[model samples]
Target: MELEEIRVAVLRIEGTNCEDETVKAFRSLGVYAEAVHLKQFYSDMIKDEEQRSLFDFHCIVFPGGFSAGDYVRAGAIFSARVKSVLKRDLEEFIREGYPVLGICNGFQVLAELGALPGFDEDKPLADKPEMALGINESNRFECRPTFLRHENDGKCVFTKKIEKGKIVMFPVAHAEGRVIFPRGREEDYLERLKENDQIVFRYVDERGNYAGYPWNPNGSIYNIAGICNVKGNVFGLMPHPERVFWRYQHPNWLENPESPGDGRAVFESVIEYLRKF
Candidate 1:
């Protein structure tokens, strides 16, 4: 598909403050992208022409922010809404091999929707959530720069442009970002993630070494910062990639200004995948 022919939907709801930046990230790549209200997908209150279908876009993104104010868990409300109305469509979209990217609060939604750790290939959506992004171990909302080491071994479409073991910095802002699997199955789940090559990114220090606390930020198991599904088409992470689409967005860019930011490679990778599809 042509770059301009590929359309991206940056799905959002009230309190999803990062949609604009998400849209900018894709548009900067010269692809068609827009911030789409969640209601426009299944709400009768919307105008007929305003309604959209999941199949309308080649790729869909769940951007960062406190969706539905993160009232019931970070993404519970939004996930519930999507499950209630658009679950089947979303499942179909995933089954069709279309790309789905989620960031921060968006990552919570995918987990809540049972869309990640998609161990069951036959079932598009897990019967229940297999993991949760809990409150940070610090017990407070953390907002700071974070370094991540790309770990995916060519299975994740989102990180294809990112060299394995390469360290990249993306800022994170969230309270509920710690990733936890079900009790008694943590080891089993982690093993499965590694075996399936689903672990895409791991938190690291400036020197690219695995570290703890502020480096891990949310205390995600195994220092995991991001992951993709078994098929590599669905991806979710805790960092805000859209916020750093350009070198100027980096906190220290003035000292070492560059055109493309570390995060830009993510968008470029996905867009390149869509072009081949």
Candidate 2:
């Protein structure tokens, strides 16, 4: 449980505002988390550089917020910057079997960058930015505490320790939280995901009282709140798990610090996964 056991890099860039919470979340698990600004990589002026390679970190996080102001599309600018500057190192990291997580706006970034499935092999079809995260079916930005049910087929490194059908609470805040896959190819993609066990997390009724609409918050395809790559190394999701790292951060659980009901499991899962590497 040493603080220096796990190494995590929390990327910070313009419009990327969730670094502190992400850092704190990992720090609580006694992991070494560093907040690295995107400017550090996008810069060409620093001659004697000591920046660590993406491979050096066991987990790399693209936390929430409207990266690049969500202009020209969410995560477009920052994604392009990453593709241009960190492409080689990032791809190497992926090939090396490390965990990469993109949360909220970060999820949008991964999709736009063709880092997720359906778009991983090539660019998405015309008019689509690899994957589409469009306006919520509700047409409004919903910010509420939510729950996600773990899928059994999901064996991703990030969610490996979470039991099947286990429901965890986290909050999602986004206007374009609805996930869109190719039309008429939904089942095919899902089957492929199932065969590969790629589906990681799904929105569910936290109270276990309802099964649709408000319980889902956003109308994501297949109730998907998050997913992983075929290799189970890269993960991208819409909810802000880092925001609920502590018991007080939870919407409930006021009198129980050891309830084990907050979002700490997400970080601990990463810690556990890193232990093997």
Candidate 3:
């Protein structure tokens, strides 16, 4: 991987931070990625007639943070602003099968934007999304490194390069990290997503068992850490994979030689997906 070969842009807005480490993660992987303030892009679009749109980027990243100070919810205000400004371009980008990833707070935005597990890509954005990442059943924000197992093979261009049952360590820090499908239809929703192979990632014990609270930190339905749109182009996850991108970011890296690159898989997965295009 080299800067000249890979191109990505970290999307940031007022009150939404954490793009710096995200840029470093991609750059470290030899991907020439940079943090682009959403306001700057919006301003450029308004000031320069010849300027290309934000959709020009290969991949767009919505990092984690308190966007709009989590007003109305974790990402409600931010998602609304994005919809108002970049709605058309964003839709076109998704339609073209380009990748868009939202991590933690970003995931909340995507869910609010009707982009994750996106049911109808052709339909206009809805007032309320059918699915949501609700408050954790635990009723507390748990900030700790946890492992997620890749459970499905078909969904998510990001997970296509990862091995089934592969355990990747990442941090989960959110008061509301639970994945909720519409009411009473829990089993049906899980069965449908599973059959479609859309259950992209899930919490799992070291031996791959779906047991223990340490593994299933927030009690997300089916221990889900993430999922993708039907087209596998739009991905969203509650855990902050982007947070642990460096070796030192892991608490026990130096003490454990067997510690493989936990956070690297995510960036690598995105790169591999883009290479196919």
Candidate 4:
């Protein structure tokens, strides 16, 4: 698809706070991107022209924020509502190689939706979530710049433009962002992700070495910051890429006044991947 022909839907619903920035991230790349409310896809109260279908866009994104007030564990409420209304469509979308991304609260949603660590290629979403983003080991929200080392060996289309081992600063803000695998199966899941080349990013300190505490932030097992589905079509992470799409958005904007931000490559990689279709 040509750049203009590519349409991206940055999905949003009540309490989703980053749609505008997410939309700006893609729009800045010259793609047709917009923030579409989840209700706009299925709510009958919406006008005919306002309603949308999952197939209308080339990519789907679930941006960050406390959806539904995060009253129910993080993204639980939003994910449940999405599955109840559009499970099949979402599954088919991922199976078709359309990109689906969830960031931060959105990451929690995909985990709750059972779409990440997608072990079964035939089953895009497991019967139940295989992992969980539990409360931070700190027991409080950790909101600050994080160094992420891109680890995927070219399987993840979303990070292809990013060189392997490259470290980028993307800010993370969440209380329940710790990625925990099934108890007694943590090493097993990590091994599988490594074996399939599914791991996308790992948290590291400024020196590019895996560290704990504030550096690893949430104390996720293996310092995992992100991962993709079995087919590499769906991805989820806890950091906010859209929050640093421009140099001015960076923490050291005055000193690192580069044209594109550290996070720009995340969007660029996907756009580059879509240009072939």
Model 2 lDDT tens row, 127-149: 23545788888888999888888
State the lDDT at 14 in candidate 1: 88
TM-score (C-alpha, index-matched) for candidate 4: 0.98
Once fitted onto the true fold, the runs of candidate 2 whose alpha carbons sit more than 4 angstroms away are 1-5, 47-50, 118-129, 207-210
Candidate 3 residue spans exceeding 4 A from truth = 1-5, 44-52, 124-127, 212-214, 255-260
Q: Candidate 1's residue-wise lDDT over 197-270, tens digit each?
A: 99999999899999999899988999999999999999999998888888998988987795688899999999
* C-alpha lDDT of all candidate models, in order: 0.92, 0.78, 0.79, 0.92
Q: Could you tell me the lDDT of residue 156 within candidate 1?
A: 93
Q: Which ten residues in a row have the lowest lDDT in candidate 2?
A: 118-127
Q: Write down the worst ten-residue block by lDDT for model 4.
A: 251-260
Ranking by lDDT: 4, 1, 3, 2
Give lDDT: candidate 1, residue 183. Answer: 91
**lDDT tens string, model 4, 29-138?**
89999899999889999999989999999999999999999987999999999999989999898888999999999999999999989988888989898999999999
Which is better, 1 or 2, measured by TM-score?
1
TM-scores for all predictions: 0.98, 0.90, 0.90, 0.98
Residue clash pairs of candidate 3: 2-30
Residues 32-59 of candidate 3: C-alpha lDDT, one tens digit per residue: 7877766655664445643446755888
After best superposition, candidate 3 residue 224: deviation in angstroms? 1.0
